[model samples]
Target: MHPRIRLELAKRWSEPHREHHDTDHLAEVVRAVDLLASSGMAFDIDTVNTAAWFHDAVYDVHRADNVERSATLAQRWLGPGEGDRIAQVVMATTDHVAATGDVESAVLCDADLSILGADTERYDRYAHAIRVENLHVPDAEYRRLRSRVLARYQARSELFATAAARELWEDQARENLARELTRLGRPVAV
Candidate 1:
């Protein structure tokens, strides 16, 4: 990536309204992607790294179109071909599930969600930051909605698509999600 683009991304990620979805989170995802690459995974490192930088570039807890908007931002900034490739990867964050055989998407999604497998203290911090991001919502509504979204993730057959990610995060992510759901007074669904 060019120095100019990296600088621009750093500015966008540092926007004041952000909480968990800020520069630190961006760095964590990049680190996660690097970790995956160091494991000798077969995905295109540059492609996935580009996607990671732009994945949450337009994060807004109130907006339902963040993924699409992020993709558009990438296309606008990076231009047609390369931007479109990265945009396709950015769009996968909408659901955090990759189509089978899409190694780059799998890598990007896994890296983006790496926090879910963080240890309790860090995971709690991340959860708190997320709540902070959406503090505009009433407490009860937030709990209800958050629980549903987490349950959907829990219900998925696999949270991490790549074998490397599964080895690193899968079990811990399941435990963390279950613990959080219980804390929310929502039954932890399998």
Candidate 2:
């Protein structure tokens, strides 16, 4: 990674309106990718780390095109081949679903979502941060939409696509989602 790119990314993530999608979240995803790579996981570490830095670069809580815009931003800094791959990884975070058979994409997605399995205190802080980011929405509406989003992950048979991620974080992620749903007055789907 170039120093210039790192500096640019830091600036983008430091935007004042960002609450959850700030530099801290970017660092967490990068750290998660590093941890996964250190554990002997076979994937392109550079691509995953690059994707992590640019994934939320264009975040806008009220905008639906953040993922697409983020991918486009990647193209400006990365070469065609690497940029395309990073774009795909960035887009994958939008749905937390990777392209079938794409290991790098799976790893990137898992790293981006690592927050879901964070311990109770950290998870609580993440939840609070997200709520702050979406403060424009009414409390009831926020709860409704947030519940749906969390339930979507909870209802999935597997929260993580990577084997290591599933083994390490699946149970905890499910527990966190379930507890959050309960607090939101949304019944956890069976």
Candidate 3:
């Protein structure tokens, strides 16, 4: 991906209404893709880059159709054939809820979880950002939701798909989830 294109995507992604899917989120995913690329995953870099820019470009947390909306936006932004590929990657992200998936989708999903494996300070900041982004929900409701999300991650076979991510991040992600669960007074997954 060109630096100029990345800048344009960053500008487009910098909307005030976006809570979690802002430029920082996109940047982090891009970094994850780079890490995966360096780890010899042979990812479709351009497709991943395009998908990262638009995955949450149309997010509506309450709307189940946001994935399709974002995919449509990706298609419009990237042009026909290339657009379809990017849309596929964007659509793959919805698999967490839809659970109908593919390898690239798995990679995207894992990359999204990469924040959990970040250095402690960055992980803490990411957690705080998520809480603030979701501050619209009442405290009790947020606690329950947060617990469910962390528990889901803890239950996964591996928090990430790529070998490098798994080796470098698996323990930290598990620890992050355990800490969050403990904070919410939920039983840690043994």
Give the candidate number with the greatest TM-score: 1
lDDT of 1 by residue, 33-102 (tens): 9999999998899999899889988888889998899999999999999999999999989999888788
lDDT of 3 by residue, 1-190 (tens): 4576566667667867666668888889889878777777765676676677778777655666987998897787677997888788788677542234455665676777788888878888888878877777899998998899789879988777666778868998888888879988899969
lDDT of 2: 0.90
Tens digits of per-residue lDDT, candidate 2, 147-188, equal 999988988889999888887788889889999999999987
Better of 1 and 2 by TM-score: 1
lDDT of each candidate versus the true structure? 0.92, 0.90, 0.76
Q: Lowest summed-lDDT stretch of 10 residues in model 1?
A: 181-190
Window of ten residues with lowest summed lDDT in model 2:
76-85
Using lDDT as the yardstick, the better of models 1 and 2 is: 1
Off by over 4 Å in 2: none
Model 3 error, position 4 (Å): 9.3
Q: What are the root-mean-square deviations of the candidates from the true structure over C-alphas? A: 0.9, 1.1, 2.9
All candidates' TM-scores? 0.97, 0.96, 0.85
